[model samples]
Target: MNFKNNKILSALLLLTLTYTTGCYKDKSNDGLTPINTVQITDPLTAGTVTVFQGDVLRLKPTLTLSMTEKMDKLEFSWLVYNSNGQISLASPRAVISNQYELNYLIQGEPFILGEPYIVRLAVKDTETGVISYINYKVSIGNKYGTGWLVLEDKAGNGDLSFIFPDSTVEHQIYSSRNTAPLVGPKKLELTPFVITDGISDVGKRLYILAETGSQEYNYLTMVKKFDYGFEFYIAPTIQKPTVMTWLSTTSGSTRSANIGIVINNGKAHSNLVGGFPGTKKWGDIALTPQGTTNYSLAPYAVGGPGVAAMIYDNTSKRFYNIIAFSNTPGAGSLTAFPAIANTPGQFDLNNVGKTMIFQDSSDVVHTYNSVMKGDDNLPYLYRYKTANTSTATPNLSISNIQMNAPGILNYTAAASSTNTGHIYYSNANVISRYEVGSNSIVETYTFPAGENVTAIKYAKYNFNDKEAVKRARLVVGTWNGTEGKLYYFALSQTGSIGSYTKQFTGFGKIVDLAYKY
Candidate 1:
């Protein structure tokens, strides 16, 4: 009666308690309470929605349930994890809402691109205490990337900086923009606007041409992230790279022509960088030279696309057709042209109108008696239109034109984007415009009285659009040894000087202003 009765009583009590409360949860309202299941009904599914850091994420998600009334008892929470799937405490969570702002680089954590984060939304049912989760992988892209990349040369030392539209300038960004510091201490030149395999926003590349190290002549040679100057695009190792240009990379395009480029370092040593397909790396262009001799180039325009360039040998002192020197794929070479006669012994050459517009020894004149006095050396321009290499021999008939009076000041000139007929030339403290067929200046812009004009280069190629109606901005450099500045200007729709636009200052001296497109 003691052992058997006690054991039987214990078993009967255990069965009765188990029936009263299923497992440990009370089942008194089991028949009255509802049974249901919930699922995320928006944002498609996992890996469906994509977002970038510091962007607005709108999630107006609804719930699909076995029964609809349970929606009222649902509670939602948001959670974000780092690329490593570690819960990022910095990522804040909010109640289910239509808009949620995401910030991956919050406070202590700075932006680390290519680091993917997973965002999960947890929705729980208060009645059942059941939870459902929907996940999304957020990737950082180059959306917040646009600006001007300025190249500076302190004495012989070279560095890079970035100036965004918001006026925030990142100085010496080369050190951080790439995995390695931009070739430094002796930056020879900056070649911006090299196209890359990546998309345009972040994929565009810039070459920080460095001075040859340990006596190597190849300048900086570090390919950089155009958006952030310091970021290196790839391993920095190139041979005597001079300049680059970009044309259509895809094969068999129906467009009118390819914007091919020709690069030359002195005796026309060549290196090209452009695309042949959408996935190719952004480096040396694809060139099938006519022969080994054709591998190099003569003097070619830096960003001149589909434009003819005159090849005047520094050693020969004689002007030759560019074709007589280098041959670029999809680009015609210079055809033979009559040798120039009685040309100035000294000249400055800037490719204007896709031809040679030279500033002679401030002396040569048109009249026969002009030589008796001496070279006027005024703002006179001698333009020679080199023929299309695929068509005919270049003509030597010169268009002897005059601009403002030229002095001993450093003068630099570049063609306008409006039309080849328009040109810009910078003097001591002035920027003057001239029309090819006109004998007088079309317009002139004088800098702040004493600011000296340092260099002139064409910028903002395809400024607003990349179509037939291309726009260009002229970047003029000026400095007083310690502080340097650049003045931006736009050409009128009709090729006239439009206005004095933006001014960027803060530098030792601007060695160059290559457009980062």
Candidate 2:
């Protein structure tokens, strides 16, 4: 019994075992029926499906199955999944019809707006006990997509209303959607759509300023995001917001990502809402041009879009400019406009001397216009021209003219035309159109006896709508002591007011109106 005898015996046993295993086979499906493959022919593959809320969603998938497989043998179910391709445990599987088609009303149940909810259909073979799954990414869109936002205040309580493109109004949207009502509305503005480092939201957002506090909301869905304090790393001690505006990187760009300026209690705060990280929060109050001197800034800023904004100082009665504030690179400091020796008596950028009534950019780039009240109790319009860059030098005064129209000093709200030389000002129940070039009132219209003008905004919408419908029109809001009405007046080519085109009633005192794109 040596090593050779042991090796020969092992080889014989291995051969016998291999022969037995190869000859014998399992008979599991030898005479059984084969499971039919469910082929969806319509959608071809799993993909995304888009549907607007409040609309009927119909999905009738075309399937190809074997003749032996009856329609009753296949049971179907629809369930929602998270955007990350995982089943949503918080959502209960809805009992959509067991039939091959799905016709369910999208009451916004289990479907969140702008979220990609994966809708899966489970097809189970009752007889064979086999199941097949097909997934479709479904997203809900808003019905109130593009429109205008109107802020109305009934005494101290504030609420919001949405006006559709066709002038259809849905009132009290803020109260109906949220648990608490908005209080003491001041202004309503929007943050432009921004794409920062390949990450962006579903749509723009609304920045609402009120007496209670400030908050941001989804422009499309009207859902609250966060309060004003969330935007600052170290929130400011005072929360009184006077004015806010989103600055664009270019004058013509629809998207903005450069800067946003907010004035809280005469102090300027800067927030970089888009672009690089570390700039999303609000920086400290901007410093004065001369670090040694303390100045009180006016509650308004003029220019942006890659240029430093011009702000007026009430203490010094002069003009100052500042760019976006950044802590890492040191906070932005206001710089004084350089003195101009060319114009002696006309105007001076460094020493305006007059109190600023209003300041805004004209339709032309680099051209800024301001309404100032002189020491003689008269209002004048002054124009300042500059370049459209961050490093541009302030030019000399373009034009300085005295507004010689009647009741100019008593004007409540003023809006200048973007494409013409017409300036519309409201005083009591009268709206006067004064031509800047002529220095005289061209036309004047008085509203009904008790209607006083509350807000006046020139229609300069950038939306791609009918030119005749949105162009060269003036939006005039009037209050008859108790109720408010919005009037639309079509302007002639010469800037003359024609008959009222349309009007909206059934609103409280309209405080502010902004056209949403």
Candidate 3:
């Protein structure tokens, strides 16, 4: 073969292959489609938004789609971005909702309280396979995060005043949020951890008991969640609620057990809730050891972390030890206290004959104090030192003394602090401090004319120890016939009030106060 001819043919073959494969073509597509993107005319402001836990979050936004886009062809979804501000791949993103209008309860979400998370709304047009997103930073809060609840009587109607941690007051919050009025306000108590909803986690609750009716509200919102009668299988015939209190005992840092005692028309009802097989209703009236005797209980009870409650039967005029916390409904009963001999400074718990006027317990001293009135028309102070109820029989000790202090008989509102030796009582406009150790009045203060002390409470906030100064405060409520005022005084070590630290007014006949956490 001729070498030059063969080489020329090889070069021509290489040139032909390059022109057909490597050279790019410049041609417009004949039948290709452009993306149909939807536009949102209004979006949730693209910043941090706050929502309260357990509240309904409803968000609706009007959208302006492209001319070619149709509402039926759009798909929507909501998802939370991971910590890196992107959709997570290690874990599947759960779809919060798949609707244009979002309505959901802020519960059971992995997001933590007071922490911000990036939530994204995705809108897709299937025709163009394109998605648009709206992102918002959301944080969860509690409406009743931390405050003091003041239950008042406004012209014979029940009202509530909330005091924020910053000392801002919200008046008539209960009446504003609820349509059904709370009438004849009597007592307000916060229950220990309870299962408000059988599905949610354990939480505290607020009970507002009154002469007209009693009801339970969400501690976080003050919204009526359940009527007090709902807590009873068979509602009481006479729904006269005087008092309700929590019972619990602690050993070291562990709360061993807890229950609630409710006094309605002098009958006692007890229940243990917030756990498996939790019976979330009041049982039948508590029965005494004596068969068939309908003994009425005093309207006051004393129990705390280190002490079990002691109930006083005014019919028998004696004290009894409460049975252990039980899950069986209607099994609450009272047992007779072991009889002890009367001593110089102590009295027998089984045979004492006195009507309990006011009683409370202190976790610091593990002691319960009571101011009782005798049949002879005299007042006495009784102290009971209780041991932790970890054993079968707890060792109980008691001390009794007749209150001979000045203004003791004229006591209108009275309160004593934990481990403090002073008992503060009010006689109309005058507030007198009596020393329990010396059985004498130590200090006294008289308010301006026309102001009568209505309620006096000693705040013992166990949740926030940072509020140490506040825990030592003595909250005094006064009414000048029209408007009520709350005065918070920082009590000294000796229980003397020089002046008030804070005063919130504009309430109506403050009858009761409780700290909410």
Candidate 4:
């Protein structure tokens, strides 16, 4: 009996030892494991967020783990610091989370503009108390808004030119009113450049065209201003003694800037092939569609070639150019090329001379084909559909004004088309409106006497000012013989023209205008 009892005790002991060993093995393999490491992948270290003040900014966070572990069990913590050195885990302007991704938004408070803020994100492992963190920087500023003006010194002269929503301001030479002298105007010898309205996804920028001359040669200069100012130039192979008109076209992410100079070959064909001298070379000044790069070049277009003008069609997302040539005539015979086309004869020949080109919202190119003489001669506005270039079509015909009229000599036309209607222009002095549906010049707004009407452009003027609403407003720079004065006019809808309310005037003549932020 004693031997049997001892055997049972030994068997029980063996069973307990086996159970203990198995428990130890299981704990070693799977229990009480420390998190190997934690990593934050996105919102990468020092990533940047660009947003306007008073806007909601969302910050997304991404994370990675040493193991393919589920994120549901993880805990998240976030912190943000302003330039002021204040600390906050939660901001009315921003939100944070512990998920694989974090999102933050700006609050309604008036935060500083053009300032940068800092943010920190962290993910904690609930099981092992492991945490991974990331830091980032963000900038705040205003997005592009309406109701603005731009000015440029195109002539590189000391004169200041400006473009407002309602008016074009041309400072007269030797006028007593010139107040603000542009930077480096006298040194640059900038004179008689071009100004155009530039639009981007975020907003618009004003471009000033000028020429800078060195002791040896001359080059075309392009100046632009937004948050900051930028200037660049292109060199032409040939030299001419006359003034040149700079033309530009933008389509999608592409842009082309060219100059038209009369070719002075001392021959009759010289007038036809190159009436405009110094416009021997074309330059590609392409801009990124997103407004990221200041300026860049894209591909070029090919065709029989002529003069080119561009208009952006928000609805179509394309740019159309009016290409006319000295050798090519007839409506359909003059082909319309997309700014991005990749074919030969899609662009004008190197020396084919053209007068004026314009584009509307429908991607149709309107060209003033008649060549005029002298700085005072103006061209007629003609229409050419993108699909049909064989026959010249009259879109907005002005009958009262004769080509090269005495006072209207050397006049240039500006045009703008919107869903509401179309505005056709002759210099800054006369503006004619046409309802798009009817395509007729329904109304004319002429500047008052002493307004320097010939300096006006439609796209550069402000139409939203209080005075502009009742009557169109224009930026006028006048010369009273002794000094040049800059004025902004608020005209009455219909009546005798009135004196302009001066905005800024002093010593410089207002030559051109541009809008900038």
Go through the candidates in order and give each one's C-alpha lDDT. Answer: 0.45, 0.71, 0.74, 0.37
Q: What overall lDDT, based on C-alpha atoms, would model 2 receive against the true structure?
A: 0.71
* Candidate 3 lDDT by residue in tens digits, 44-98: 5655678887677677666776555378889999786444434444534567889
Tens digit per residue, CA lDDT, model 1, 1-517 = 7999999999999999987677446544565656788877654555534554334555555768888866677776767556544546465443333222233332113323445655677878788888888777665543335556666766665666666555566566544333543333322232333334333333333444444321111112223324221122342244343433333312222322123233434333222223244433222322322322233333233212223333443332334333211254433332334433344532223222222223211111110000001133344444433222233432333454444434322455343433445556677677876555564467788877667776676543543444543365677778765777877676555555566567777765666555442
Q: Can you tell me which runs of candidate 3 are displaced by over 4 Å?
A: 1-26, 29-49, 53-118, 123-129, 192-201, 251-253, 272-280, 304-307, 325-331, 341-344, 362-364, 388-395, 460-471
Q: How much is 376 displaced in model 2, in angstroms? A: 1.9
Query: What TM-score do all the candidates reach, one by one?
Result: 0.51, 0.76, 0.77, 0.35
- Per-residue alpha-carbon lDDT of candidate 4 for residues 1-517, written as tens digits (9 for 90 to 100): 9999999999999999999999999888866655556666653454577775334666565555567655666777766556544544443444354444545445333344555566667677777777777777767754322332223233344443333344443333211223333342211122122322121212222322233221110111122222111111233333221222234333322333332221111100011113234322322222223322232111112111233432222222233333423444421121223222334323321112223333333213422222112233443323322223334431221111113222223345443432133444454455544433354456565555544432333322354654444345444444433444445545444321256455564434444433332
Judge candidate 1 against the unseen true structure and give its global Cα lDDT, from 0 to 1.
Answer: 0.45
Deviation in angstroms for 136 in model 1?
A: 5.0
**Residue pairs with clashing backbones, model 2:** none
| Cα deviation of 5, candidate 2, in Å | 35
lDDT, model 4, position 344: 32
Better of 1 and 2 by lDDT: 2
- TM-score of candidate 3 to 2 decimals: 0.77
Error of 2 at 264 (Å): 0.4
Candidate 2 local lDDT, 470-505, one digit each (tens): 567788888998998988887765778867888998
